[model samples]
Target: MYGAFWRILPGPWWIRLLIVLVIVAIVLYSLVTWVFPWVQELTNATDVTVGG
Candidate 1:
């Protein structure tokens, strides 16, 4: 699957690497900004205490 993705990207090696890095950055940003916070709210994990 990864091989197919690399093959599908159109560019030299450096350009392809930059594209992959940008995609990764966007995914991480969305997770941190929205997805993780939503999941935290749903789970209400902050109030839990360990061995208290």
Candidate 2:
């Protein structure tokens, strides 16, 4: 699967690397900005105590 993606990207190696990095950054930012907070709300993850 990864090899197919790498083959499909339309660029030289460095350009492909840059594009992949940008894609990863966008995904990470989206997850952190929206997805994580939504899941946290659903799970109530902040109100936790380890060992009182």
Candidate 3:
């Protein structure tokens, strides 16, 4: 899968590396800004002792 992605990207090694980094940053930012919050809401987790 990753091999296919690298093959599809149009650039030299350094440019491809930069593009991969940008893609990773965008994915991480989206998870942090949206996905994680939605998951947390679904789970409804809270801090509390399970037993005495």
Candidate 4:
């Protein structure tokens, strides 16, 4: 979260910024690596079972 970055940002702005960027990059990579494949499979699946 940006809130985490803010706490770490008081010192050298570049390094904190790099950390934040890395975190965001990792999160985005995770979503692409995990969530996206699941979503594609679920949406593409023909035998989906939904309940209310």
Candidate 5:
């Protein structure tokens, strides 16, 4: 399983931390791009403005 894989792979903490960060960033990006629009639709916006 994944737990075993994590235990078997030997590396520094920063390398593991970097991998976790990259995975998290990828998942977050996927959620924001593909799933966030539905979330936005569910909420009501009272005020909004774009200066640019």
Candidate 6:
């Protein structure tokens, strides 16, 4: 699967690396900005107690 994706990307090796980095950055940013907060709210993570 990864091999197929690498082949499908356009440009030389350095350009491909740059594109992959940009894609990773975008995914990480979205998770931090939106996905993680939504999941935290759904789970009520801050309300959990370690012991009682």
Best model number under TM-score: 3
Q: Per-residue CA lDDT of candidate 2, range 6-52, in tens?
A: 99999899999999999999999999999998988899766778977
Tell me which of candidates 3 and 5 scores higher on TM-score: 3
lDDT of 5 by residue, 1-52 (tens): 9777566655886777777788889999999997888887887675567565
lDDT of each: 0.95, 0.94, 0.94, 0.83, 0.77, 0.92
How many residue pairs clash per model?
0, 0, 0, 0, 0, 0
Candidate 2: segments with Cα more than 4 A from true spot:
46-52
**Residue 5 error, candidate 3, Å:** 0.5
**TM-score of predicted model 3?**
0.89
Residue 32, candidate 6: C-alpha displacement in angstroms: 0.3
**Which 10 consecutive residues of model 2 have the lowest summed lDDT?**
43-52
- Candidate 5, position 37, lDDT: 80
lDDT of candidate 1 over 1-52, digit per residue (tens) = 9999999998899999999999999999999999999998899766768777
What TM-score, computed on C-alpha atoms, does each candidate reach? 0.87, 0.85, 0.89, 0.63, 0.53, 0.86
lDDT of 3 by residue, 1-52 (tens): 9999999999899999999999999999999999999999898577666875
Q: How many backbone clashes does candidate 2 have?
A: 0
List the candidates ranked by TM-score, beginning with the highest: 3, 1, 6, 2, 4, 5
Model 2: how far residue 23 lies from native, Å: 0.2
Please provide, for model 4 over 1-52, each residue's C-alpha lDDT reduced to its tens digit, 9 standing for 90 to 100: 8687588575677888887798899999999999999998878676668964
Q: Which run of 10 residues does model 5 get worst, by summed lDDT?
A: 43-52
CA shift of 38, model 1, Å:
0.4
